[model samples]
Target: MESEVSRKVDFSIIRYAQCWEDPEILLEVLDIKEGDVCMSIASAGENTFAMLVKNPGKIIGIDLNPVQLRLVELKKAAFLALEYEEMLEFLGFSESRRRKEYYGKLKDYLLGETEKYWNENMALIEAGVINTGRFDNFFQIFRKKVLSLIHSQKRVAELLEKKNKEERYEFYNKKWNNLRWKILFRIFFSKFIVGKLGRDPRLFDYADNTSLSAVMSEKAKYAFTELDVSENPYIEYILTGKYTKNLPFAMRKENFQKIKSNLNRLELHNVSIEKYLETSEETIDKFNLSDIFEYISSEKYKELLEKIYEFSSNGAVLAYWNMMVPRSRPEELGNKIISLSETAKNLHAIDKTFFYSGFVVERIVK
Candidate 1:
């Protein structure tokens, strides 16, 4: 039977055009060794492709939404068919008037359904695929409407300027964190507004009664002041419509060729994680379970962990984010799974995707 969360959230459309989590934190926590077998949630395929840069023996990307799987397939095809610059332009990272032409080159590489999907959505192709998702559109609206009310273009550019921690804090305190910014940010990001405009309300099924805006407001402040804004592609994307400076780990030029060369190691599956694990034959070495537990109940979360443990090799590591609802290795499963709390904490401190409340890493002991 489909879960309530699954049934309620629309899966027919692209929810996220790009993976929002920081692959840097993921790589640091997983510490993938060459030849490691990794399993990751395929949300827009960014992190999965990023994992390939590590030369993993194989990467299995599983997602419940076939639309998301198609997005991954399209990106993989882009890497295989286009040059680095062409791929960036084709994916909407860089300016290009020739994206449709580039897509023509990639047509042969795409699966039948994926080709048909893209062919039907040429407007998205023209606008840039990275900016086409519901979540991405939400950010676009914020940038155009909400953000302009709070700061001018010059102020936004100044916020991205390279600065030391002390200087950044001073700038934020004196110039950025004004009354208007706080009131507008909270109103835009409140649970009700976010559910309607940014994400599916069903996604918050397991979230507590805490104020979403309050938590997110503090997180935004941390990303702006404590983190290096110049080096954070996420901040760059949120403030600007595209990546103007640093790119994500997978999209960076230094790692592009490496990921392209290892494309054969990547695999995609359209199914739930529990379903995939139940039928899978491979023993996974690392798991990038990206914030999926936030939508499900605690009992369901523990049950899924138990299923994952059955297919995990001894000493295998699992990493996931807690955006709102808190979840971790259940105490009853302590004998089999050990929480790497300290490492998770250390990595979370530097996580560029600052909206998540917690990042959890665990290992299978048996």
Candidate 2:
């Protein structure tokens, strides 16, 4: 199979910020806080910027891909630098039947660089995100096309009206059960949503076909917070996409309401965790690896730790996670592994799905 995660970023912020696989619930497990310097992989720019909401001293978001970097730049541009409400309307925050108003809002805000990118990379903006200018009309057109093709036109229309989480859950579970599904999901959701959406490409990315199924199953069992909708409403909505039929909160402009004044604190980069550690002029108090090590091989896992150990001072706190795959880690790193009992217990107490496989690991620098 073509490796989808071959495109997976090293320290992407967007993936963590947008579709964290468990947004509203994973906060406790992440244990990240304000005034803390956080470093995360920038995937979609969502979590990279979202870190600002917590009032971090500095959020260093790093990625290698120019396209991903640009997208985060656009989110930062649209939110940090642009007019707030207009940015939201331009990026599909609320439901609107008035398509012209949606498209009109973006045309006004389109900047020079963003406009050039839009004109030149229209295909990317269609399949990807446009961070610089107004993307209202662009995405609206794209959304229409996707809905038309999915044969989900009315379902998409009805979904737009869902204003909050509860309504979204009800609509998906009982009303649009059929419409609430994706072929990808029917084939992969139960097993691979977390893996595909996870921080590591190795556990999900480099797996053998047989192992991929097991990875998917492990991922689904942990992330499937939707056992009974009444009991686990958020998980139900997440699994069904019944909630927030719109794009994720990170993509919405309203998130800036919480992050507006704190934008400058948002520092973005395009580098690996290793490269960032090697070259940065910063000391990180907290790190969210999001299972970064799951991507490394037996030999590389050692190198990953050597890099982490090089920067980590004794007793310095580190928070990341890994899959406990059979023989996943070589003995060298495993020998140094010290599971912070206090943090591990807290993760168990909190049923956040991303860290669901008891994926939270809090280790102090030895």
Candidate 3:
């Protein structure tokens, strides 16, 4: 497999503090239970925290990016060191004038590397770690510069308040969705801009066959017209800078005690998925690999899948998403893999974060 260092130019930076996919839908499909040893990509650690609520026997999170692993460690430390309200304040969910002092307290619970990382990125903590990453920065530009010009804050908030799908569709079509909106949306999320600002340019090759702008437009339409935006934190954060009533499961108040109690269940590894799979002798019962396949070549993806198949236990379920780029198991492995395409389709219909073009779940039959 290609190393992330050679593949992504922005590997060192914090690319995402909050993941784009909805973990609620993901966990529904995951159907995790006790005694399950799960494997996941530690993107922002949101899904990992969600998995902990399931009371799994073990969860091994792997990430090639050190910054991403640091974020997870910081969160784990917050749970160990701070009270619920104080944890929220330190995590940027609420305001705190003494974040530095709070960090001083939290650092004792963190590893030396993780503490140093947060110490170096104190500005990010002060500004709200949720909105500080590069991907968030890209969205900030669009929200402030383009989206703000197209619609007023009240109008945008109103779009979230519609009672039903009919009401939403009517409001979106009549007031929000216009030629100007389409033109600006296309320009802002076009391949040229997203490739540079959001993700690496090399990943664009896999999505060359599809229209990136159209996928984005369709996703935007679904978020506005079909899904309930009242609790969709992804959209809430993108439009406004905060999560009011609804936050990710990891950050929610009720789940804090559960996460804190089960903190020992989660283990973090600063390594690639392939590396972890190769070294890990335990069979993974559930796999939550985000869109990592989108970044690699088809051959590399196939190789990685083969490794995953080897690491996974029989009947093990796996879930992943297709952002603009699409990927699937090689034809040669069809007999060993059972596709959950229909379930994926049904779940995709109600996906709160309509960012991904496709959602796929499969099981190992062999």
Candidate 4:
């Protein structure tokens, strides 16, 4: 088992507050009505809660990590038990003795299993509001282990600051080709970065790329990106890091109220998007999959299409972001399901460099 310190938080949770998401995007992608049941992944949990603001039939949140599940529980508990001001304060607005008081009073609202996690994690809380997200402060390990090792910030700056992608790409290839670079990567991760806050150290691993334990450990390496990183800690961090500073609003702190209100109708799950499309018993009226497909290769997309068909109705809507690679067309899934909008032919669009550079697509069930 890798240490939680290295494995806990990263870039994903940080930018969770900013990227393009929800109300603006979900309605476009999911086409979900006010009372529709919604399902989603609870990466940072902002969307899960945000969708609730729409007053859906229900909101289900799923995640592979107990940590994330716990985060959801905390968010929901906060929504159910705390006042708006206290909720804001607990999540990201402030750090006060009021926090201890809130935890003490809200004990009744929390589930039995979640109690222990809360009790222990409570001691770690501090002044920053950002500490309230899914994987707070965990990136400190990432910085100490990997970012710190970049020998020269000057070269790092030139590579990242270069305006042109082609030039940047070439520079990255040259920098990584040097033997010293690879050695640092291996060494920083060798023992997993140690942490005083918890018992275990942290190691580098992409939780999204993990499979069932039946597979070999090395098999997980398949997710490593080939994109050029140019030794720029930021870009390399973006390629390998967790949170992106640029995510949708639903992922942010400002809209947590919307997420809380819509909680009942939104369901967050830990399972893969492909799994839902395959196994769902009925065709949901709307489906919004942020760009999970980008993480996978083209061959695996069939599972997605087939599964989506099972879960959709003629009027059912499909929405997703097409990451850097051209979005995979479900044309083979047949013409019945087709694009309804040209601006949305790519369904939807957010004008920003998100963790995923992609287009939002909205497809209808024929």
Best by lDDT: 1
Residue 104's lDDT within candidate 1 is 93
Clash count list over all predictions? 0, 19, 0, 47
lDDT per residue as tens, model 3, 20-79 = 788887899999989899998898887888889999999999888888889888888888
**Whole-model lDDT per candidate:** 0.91, 0.49, 0.83, 0.49
Angstrom error at residue 14, model 1: 0.6
Q: How do the predictions measure up, each by TM-score?
A: 0.98, 0.62, 0.96, 0.58
Q: Put the candidates in TM-score order, highest first.
A: 1, 3, 2, 4
Error of 1 at 317 (Å): 0.5
lDDT of 1 by residue, 1-366 (tens): 234356667899999999999998899888899999999999999999989988999999988888988888989999999999999999999999999999999977987898899999999999989999998899999999999999998999999999999999999999999999999999999999889988898899888899999999999999999889888889899888988888988999898899999999998988888777777799999999999989988888888888889999999999999987999988999999999999999999899999999999999988
Give model 2's TM-score versus the native structure: 0.62
Q: How big is the RMSD of model 3? A: 1.6
C-alpha positional error of residue 78 in candidate 2 after TM-score superposition, expressed in Å: 1.7
Per-residue CA lDDT of model 2 for 161-239, tens digit only, reads 4245556666655655443234333443333433444333435543334444344444443333222223332332333
Ranking according to lDDT, highest score first: 1, 3, 2, 4
- List ranges where model 4 is wrong by over 4 Å: 1-23, 95-97, 123-262, 267-270, 273-279, 322-326, 334-336, 345-355
